[model samples]
Each structure stands twice: as structure tokens, then as C-alpha cells.
Target: MNLRTFTAVLFALTLPAPPAVAEVGLSPFAGFRMSSSVDIETAGASADDQIHFRDSPSQGLALNFDLAEPGKQGELYFSRQSTSARLDNGLFAPGIESIDLTIYQLQFGGLYFPGGKSYGGFVSGVLGVTRLEPEDSRYDSHHRAALSLGGGYQFFLTEQLRLRLDLRGVYTALNSGGSVFCSGGCELRFRSDGYLQVEAGAGFVMRF
Candidate 1:
């Protein structure tokens, strides 16, 4: 080989390689959720009925993509939880069958990490629909607009694994403009009600 060619090859080998670009990731998680009690009101009724939801388990999955800047991510997520509902009014007999209430949501939001990755805190806001499913055959399920504000912390266990703890407040608006008849032919009209659910849980997050 010529002397100039050998010098060029040596110079090329000594140059540093370019840095790797960050890619998008997907994370799937599972955790437990606890919801607060909601009030059910009826027009022309003497008092309101309270539906107490028991603490239950929840599961979800999330997609994480790059935003305009580094250390910020846009997320699309879906979660579901099932709990038993008990009527807290004296009108119902004791030991009555508890109704099953299932809640689910699909949301889009952005998460920000202040400490520049690794272990940090994040905050996000979500807007979506919340569905309430009742086990009783006579009553149909209901869906309403939902909004949530949440913040959490994430700890990196490995390069592709994380442990997360989250606390969120979910607000749902429920308005059923229908009537239901009691056993004695008395009619009860449903009214607009707001449900505030508080959830706190820890999850294991796997990234891909």
C-alpha cells in the first residue's frame, strides 16, 4: 500500500464513533388501585344513596414516545379496575348481593422528568372517558367524561425495568336523566352526580 493510503486508514480508525440516538419505548405495568365512595342522588327522594367501592386491583399498559425535548415523553395509556359496590342506605336489606363496579379509562398525556432520567418524579394530566359497569341485569352500564391529575416517582431497577409509585385523582361526571320505579310504583328520577376517585398504587414497569 502507498504511504498516503496507510496514513488515511490510521486517521479514520482513530476518529470517535457517533453517539447513538434515543428511540421510543413501550412500557406495560400492573398495580393495585383504591377508589373513593360516590354519592348517587335521585330527584324527589328524601335522601341520597352512597355507593361504596372496595379497594381493588388494577392493570394497565403505556406507550412512551419522544416529545420536542429530551427528558420529556408523551404517553398513551389504558387502565382498568374492578371493585364490589355496596349500597350504604338503610332501604336495602342487610346481606344484599353486592354489585360489581368496573372502571376503565383510555388517556393521553405528557410526562416530565426534572432530574434528567434515571430516578425522578413526573406529573401528568389526562382526559378520557370513564365507564362504570354494573353487574345487575336490570340496570345498564354508564359512561361519562373523565379527567385526571397525577404525579409519581420512578426508580430504575435495570436498563429496561423500573418500579413506580403513583397517586392520582380522577373526576367523572355522571348524569342519568331517567326514572326507576320502586316496588310500590313510586318513581325515582336520576340526577347529575360527580364522582371523585383517589388512587394510589405501586407498579412494576417493563420497557421495550
Candidate 2:
């Protein structure tokens, strides 16, 4: 080979390699929710009532796309809980009796790892809306701004799968004096700060 051709080939080989292709992870998780409740003031009643939601099971799925940065991923999260709610007040109220409710959280967010490892711990934050739906035909669904702060560690089980244990503190916004689940027959007025709940979940993350 000619000297010039050899030198050109050598320079091309010395160039740095490109970054590795990113990965995607899908996780279907199941867990429990704690301390879910809301305070309400009935429209035509003198006393305020508390609606207490029972602690129940929650299941969800999360889809994550790896970013250009190592250990960073964009996440789409969704969760649902079907449970019952009862009145805390002793007096009989006309509206919202023996309420069976379904709650959902749909969010978009990201996760960050300080250690920058796939098998290590990471923190996540999600911003979205909390949807509270009643089984009763008279009441309509309610949607409110919500957020969650969470973190967890992933345990490596195989090259294609890992186990993740996660915990999150969720907050749903309830602006004071806002009416919810309103229809001609029954309505509820919210009072107090907001609604707060905690979740603990474990799931398998499949990577591709």
C-alpha cells in the first residue's frame, strides 16, 4: 500500500467510537396506598364532614426511555386504586353515602441517579393530575393537579430483567372552597390543605 493511503486509514481508525445505544425499561408494579382521605363541607349542612378512604392495593405501569446521559431516563407512569370511602361524621348526610371510588394517577417525569449505575438507587419526580371517580351515577369525575416524589434501588436479577422496590409520597391539590363530584342531587365542598397519600410498590423492570 502507498504511504499516504496507510496514514489516512490509520487516522480513521484512531477516531473515538460513538456512544452506546440507549435502553428502554417497562415495569408493571403493584403495591399499597396509605392514609388516603379528604375533608369536605356539605353545601347545605352546618357541620363539616370527613371522607376517609380505606387503605387499599394499587397497581400501575411505568415506561422509561433512556436518555443520552448515563443513568437518566424519561418515565411515563400510571396507577389506579379501587376502594371505598365512608363518612367520619356521626350525623347522617344526604350526599356521598357509602361511596365506592376509583383513583388514578397519570404522570410524566424522569429519574436521576447520583451513582449513575443501573443497579443502584435513583430518585424520581412526577407531575400530573389525580383523577377521583365515583361509581355512583349521580356524581361526575374530578381531576386535580398532583405530584409524587420517590426513590428506589434496583436489584439485578438478569441481563434482561431487574427487581425494583419503590416508595412515593403523593399530593393532590384541592384548592379550598372548590366543589367536587357535583350533580343536581348531591355535591361536596372541599376544605383544608389537600389530599396526601403514600405508596409502596415492587416490580420487575424488563430492559431492552
Best by TM-score: 2
Misplaced by over 4 Å in model 2 are 1-22, 90-96
lDDT of 2: 0.84
Which runs of model 1 end up more than 4 angstroms from their true locations?
A: 1-20, 90-96, 116-119, 176-192, 204-208
Please report the TM-score between candidate 2 and the true structure.
Answer: 0.83
User: What lDDT score goes with residue 22 in model 1?
Assistant: 42
Largest lDDT belongs to which candidate?
A: 2
Candidate 2, residue 19: Cα displacement in angstroms equals 14
All candidates' lDDT scores?
A: 0.69, 0.84
- TM-score, each model? 0.75, 0.83
Q: What tens-digit string does per-residue lDDT give for candidate 2 at 1-208? A: 9999999999999999875543888999999999667888877656688878889999999998888888888999999999877778733236436678899999999998787766679999999999989888666788899999999988988766889899999999997778766667455678866888999999999988
